[model samples]
Target: MSMGKKILIIGPSWVGDMVMAQSLFILLKQQDPDNQIDVLAPAWSRPLLARMPQVRQAVDMPVGHGSLMWSARRQIGRALKAEGYDQAILLPNSFKSALIPLFAGIPVRTGWKGEFRYGLVNDIRLLDEARYPLMVQRFDALAYPAGAPLPEKLPVPDLHAEAARVPQLRAQFGLDGTQKILALCPGAEFGPAKRWPERHYAAVAAHKLAQGWQVWLLGSEKDRAVAENIIAALPQAQRQRCHNLAGVTKLEDAIDLLSVCDAVVSNDSGLMHISAALNRPLVVVYGSTSPGFTPPLNEQVAILSIPVDCGPCFQRECPLGHMKCLNDLLPEQVISALEKLVPGHEQAVL
Candidate 1:
């Protein structure tokens, strides 16, 4: 038996991208069972990497996103020289993302040609978006030779949750995990354009609560207000069953807790990807963005979007005053999608 190749991957900064990167890791491991994979990512992604079984270890990228701290990157890169990584795969297209591996003197650095990353990455492949339509496809392609045919059955990211901590997390959050859980992720880090209306979320929550299910609102502190608004929209009795855990739980806690959800209704956000990776029955709503590019990788997912003329603009906020793309997308549509993904739920309230 021979020790396989050791690879260092410069991971993406966003949570969703990091989740998708697991596909590439799975592909590498599938190709070579002995392959050792280490991820270089932001500190926030450490918990995410921990959930990925393919990752041997996660090295935190000292430099923040968009920061070109040459000396800092050099220091970190030089420090990793002792690891003797056989190959470095850069997931981000930024020129800065390629610098560390180059500085570390890692042989066979691989990535797409972006931002004039000519000499920085020796094994650069010009990306053909038409050929590789999905982001996961592009990432998985790097695991093989340039222009090589990707596996017909690409592995979807399946994140492992710390089930032992489920009890502790439930106790900490005053949740018993006795009732059916329906998680609603209404916040989009991308911006307001991607967020489904709060009232719409409330409608879903109200319906689930009527069916004797608990609603868990998930997001960062930035989404606390939105979560609160959703709860406020619910009737007083329904609000009692709703948990506003948006700002309350850490990323890891959210991951473990989300594993127990019977179903999830979310915007096209990081948590949406997380829920899908957990293999939860997911209903994802898209507004400013379209599913053509980064649809949920899970099989049990329903993506809902209303097409408008001004649409899929991929903007932070709607350019026109009316956000008909999202506002026009009724809660009933999402509830219908959810019922399709997870049957036996009560009919939605119009």
Candidate 2:
């Protein structure tokens, strides 16, 4: 039993990756209740870290992702030395990600052997994709000794939302709590390749609205245009019932608001992971990416992806000049998946 061992985690920069990292935090707490877990991530992830009970605190990483700010890394690492973190876990497989922990002089630095991070991480493990197929599994493996068998039942990421704030957020957004809410996440930060067609999203929104459900489009400021396009495609009556909340609410507000949603239809983006963590019924549409690697870590999720010969290409955009993978995926498929995921919704209006 490692008692009172403080651990520091170099978290991933992407939103979905940060959410999935909670599984590792849960495993650390399970291993020893006295373990103090702190995350070093981007400034934006503070709100996310607040939702995870296992995290003691979130230290903002001063350097931007992929930036080789040697002096900044050294300063941050030296500053954390007094806290005396027993171990530092590196979530990103980048050489730069290991620099801070190494400079901090943490005794045990653990991570996968990525990008010549040989001496940077003292307790490095070679990743076996088959053994740890899911991203959650890879994160959890860092908590245990090398070659140790993982627990049969791994803990899933469950973010805690403030029920009290739900109503306040709804009021702030002028949302009606009387109707069943269907949250639509139509943007993917990775790029357009991962995003489902906006017309498809409008179709789902229209169908749900006709069935007496309110639609809420959720995303960051970058997604506002896409949200508007979805609304523009809908009839005025249906658009009246659809609320475009993208770029309006803070991430924390979105988190609390999403908790109140009956179901969520999203691309394989960060909000999809957030919705899953909130335990909402989720239908994730995958285009360029495949769910075989990083599926939403929730039982209530229905993954929709078309098998295209050019697909699972994992590119930022379509290489063949056509996004047939997402374009070919009909809205009816997503609606049917939603009906199966959440009962009582009317059949998709073609």
Q: Clashes in each model (backbone N, CA, C under 3 Å)?
A: 0, 0
Over the stretch 107-179, how does candidate 2's per-residue lDDT look in tens digits? 9999999998999999999999999998889999999999899999999999999889987887887999788
Best by TM-score: 1
Query: Candidate 2 at 258: error in angstroms?
Result: 0.7
**Local accuracy by lDDT, each model:** 0.93, 0.92
**What are the models' TM-scores?**
0.98, 0.97
Candidate 2 Cα misplacement greater than 4 A, ranges: 345-350
Q: Candidate 1: where is the Cα deviation over 4 Å?
A: 345-350
Candidate 1 lDDT (Cα, 0 to 1): 0.93
